[model samples]
Target: MRACGLVLCVLLLGGCSTTTDPSYYWQSVSGHLRMVGAARPVDDWVADGRTSEALRAKLRQAQQLRRFAVTELGLPDNNSYTRYADLQRRAAVWNVVAAPDDELKLKQWCFLALGCVGYRGYFDEAQARAFAEQVRHAEPDVEVGVYPVPAYSTLGWTNWMGGDPLLNTFLGYPEGELARLLFHELAHQVVYVRDDTVFNESFATAVERLGGARWQATASEAARAEYARFDERRQQFRALARATRERLQTAYALATRAERLAAKQRAMADFRQRYDALKAQWNGFPGYDPWASQANNALFAAQAAYDELVPGFEALFEREGRDFTRFYDAVRALARLPKDERRAALGSR
Candidate 1:
């Protein structure tokens, strides 16, 4: 049955060819199949003698998190995260994002089901970097960035093929972080607005933040303490990034092209200096060094999709009395609205 489902999924993915490049679709299909093929039932791994005790413990914890997502957070209950795969890779996929040299708006890629999104993803890091190079060569005025993605969601499209299995890429996350990542991905299955990357990502992030806090309340003191340190650094880094993005947006809006370009360079330099000072305060934490060093329009634009409108969604959740189901229903209503209207509604709230 699972094999038949996999075949059907391939056909469906292949048949829905909206992109001009057939190779892209082929890579997408093959990459997904390879990952799915590598996965086995979590129970099997837990019982296997070859499975180390450490991995076995993480797998069991993942199941518990999966259950909490469904029963407590009102996330989808499915085969996702019920199985495990070891990709033996640093990242599950690499994403390429590009933007105009002076603009914070990212280039868009349209697809059959995903509609238009800000970034394109490749299962192979080489392919992703190659594509970014192509974009840079073709458009001299475009800024391109390639980044590693730990995980992505299919929005429950391939549930019949055992859903989206947990991968080694993120299974070892701290307990709160693991819960946050799981809740965030499952939220995609709840409400996805095609073409509105900001809305979709922000909504998922809101769910993760809310669910993470709830999970942490019941977590062991050790787990909670670990997540606290991790989250504190993350929050500080995000703040710095957010401030820089705002400065760049102002620079991008300058009247003349030359003025915009000059302002942008100044803003970027100030951003780096500020980040350096922030890093010094962190006692030598370097987690955000790569991102700060490579900051540009494309990177800032990609980051916006995840950060923009998060506060509004968080507020909406509060307005819904923090009931997950009610909040989701409200978000679904917003998703059904025209993009402009949806943004207006979220903003007004």
Candidate 2:
């Protein structure tokens, strides 16, 4: 839901801010999600200003880092922060959805009521937990970060986090990676047609990862530490995201609508089973339990995002001589053509 809102925002908001209503963000999300599946009823928008002047300025700094990426790194860069708002934005354009999609309306309300403001595009806690548990069982011992909005972010009270850090607009990314992610998401905002959240996120997350790595190389030890911390969390995050996607695939395999729904329910249950098992498995590992308890469906869904779409990006990164600027340009070029043509270009590259 929040992802949808972000898509509209990023698409609507270029480099400047004309409107900054948080509810507008949420409304966009609901409408987009509903379009793909079932449009649920949402009364009022309740998103507060997660992005203030300070945050906007910070985001712009992140954006400036992107310009450096293109000019300095010679990699093709895409924008996420300045482009696509976050998970919701990507979803709006990509067309993915919740199973009981009707539940999405309730979920969206819960997001705003609870404090969700769409961090890096996705906001839904119930989903992340289910996904995280799967990762815990699968990996048994990796750091995972589940950032929900204040209305969404769970780790908001942590002293280490910055003030009013409710929504993680950059998917819990630190400075440099944040910049890259902004570019990647923006790229999606600029050219994404529809029903290609995977392509959009893959491209953005790829930029986030590869561009982040390149950007990190230029950072100080502290910045590196932040990146290390985020990376560590993302590792387990990826595991859960992978499991969630697999579950979704299993759900999608069902033929009839009833069967599909049943499959969705079963897949969610299985996701819980897998997630719990993983959490228990990782209980003994170092630095791995603080967030396990909060690994709800929303959290899992958030992480699952990365798991499903990163491969395409990895493929692209390797092909572009790891040059992100060129890679960004290449992806934009692909956007000009169709996915098939893009794939062909990638193959040739």
Candidate 3:
């Protein structure tokens, strides 16, 4: 939807021709319900229906999450999810999404709670799919799974309470790290520097580690185990991200110099060849094929972005002595600083 007549519609969600009413969110739920009723349906996927059992299970899960959100997260009881869909639809979804037509309604929900009202969510699958397709067409190396969308991307304006159900798995993590995953994404929602992919992602990476424990405390033992599994997987990811970052440094030096273009190409080709071999060397570990085939301009542009400043996350975590709350305040404080100022702060005592 258009925010204050601005073209803020995330084009991938099958956005309509005109901008949406951003201020509409300022209204109450009754107001949002009326607003959505007048809008046009977004995509063909909107008509696709879930099975009865699926709906029931989703509702149950959502109820669980609603309780979690309130009991653990301390959100308001009367969340927007209540007005949108019944327990069934909300439970099935891990995040709440706005349809092209329901922009104002979603925004209202966002504006009202500043976080999710319930545990479960609603989303426009078509839009998420469209964004996925666009991201894919733009950069094939990045693989996204719609398990839960990145909260930072969707909930920023709403104050990072709600989250999308989409996730990235370019390099899959090990089992039992669900808490880490949640923490990582939540961290992104907490603070993000616009268009600065590396800084934003790295900050989230650090938070995921620091915040995992607190988030897990709300869930059951099984959920906590999942976080451990996820952690193991992350250990491997750290290696890959670091390697990618170093490799990108080399690649970038070559990319900038015209005279070395051909040499760089040859070097990259060799690097890819070695990378493939390197990937194969750890055959039982993980597969790199599916993503490699989708290489494009974005892939080249963000080739080694995965671990460019991993040490920053590591350093922050270490500096806080693994104190989660302290880490949170520290980062949020730093986020207030300008780019260079933040860097200087990081470097100074």
Taken over the whole model, the C-alpha lDDT of each candidate is 0.83, 0.44, 0.39
Highest-lDDT candidate? 1
- Model 3 scores a C-alpha lDDT of 0.39
Per model, state how many residue pairs clash.
0, 73, 28
- In candidate 2, position 285 carries an lDDT of 48
Residue 13 C-alpha lDDT in model 2:
26
Segments in model 2 whose C-alpha atoms lie over 4 Å from true places:
1-5, 9-67, 73-97, 100-173, 189-191, 251-267, 273-309, 340-349
**lDDT at 242 for candidate 3?**
44
**TM-score per candidate:** 0.95, 0.49, 0.50
Full candidate order by TM-score, most accurate first: 1, 3, 2
Compared with the true structure, what per-residue lDDT tens digits does model 2 show for residues 1-349? 1221233322222221233546546644553343323211111111225445554555456546757656665533331122323334211232112212211111121122222222233334444445445445654323233443211111112112221111233434457545554444434433343334445555655655666676777788998887676566557645665666566656656677677567667766765666566556656443334334544344444444443546765786688787656666767777778757665654522
| Residues 23-140 of candidate 1: C-alpha lDDT, one tens digit per residue | 7877778888889999999999999999999999999999999999999999999888888999999778888889999898899877665677788888889999999999999999
Q: Which candidate is the best by TM-score?
A: 1
When 1 and 3 are scored with lDDT, the better candidate is 1
**Model 3 over residues 1-349: C-alpha lDDT tens digits?**
0000001122222222232543322222332233234322222113336435544444344445444444443333442222122212211222222211101111112222222211112244454456446544664433332223222233234222222332221112322243344345445545655434455655655554444445666666776676565455445544554454345445445533553445445544654665566556556444344334443223333323333455676687678876555666777787777777776655531
Who is ahead in TM-score, 1 or 3? 1
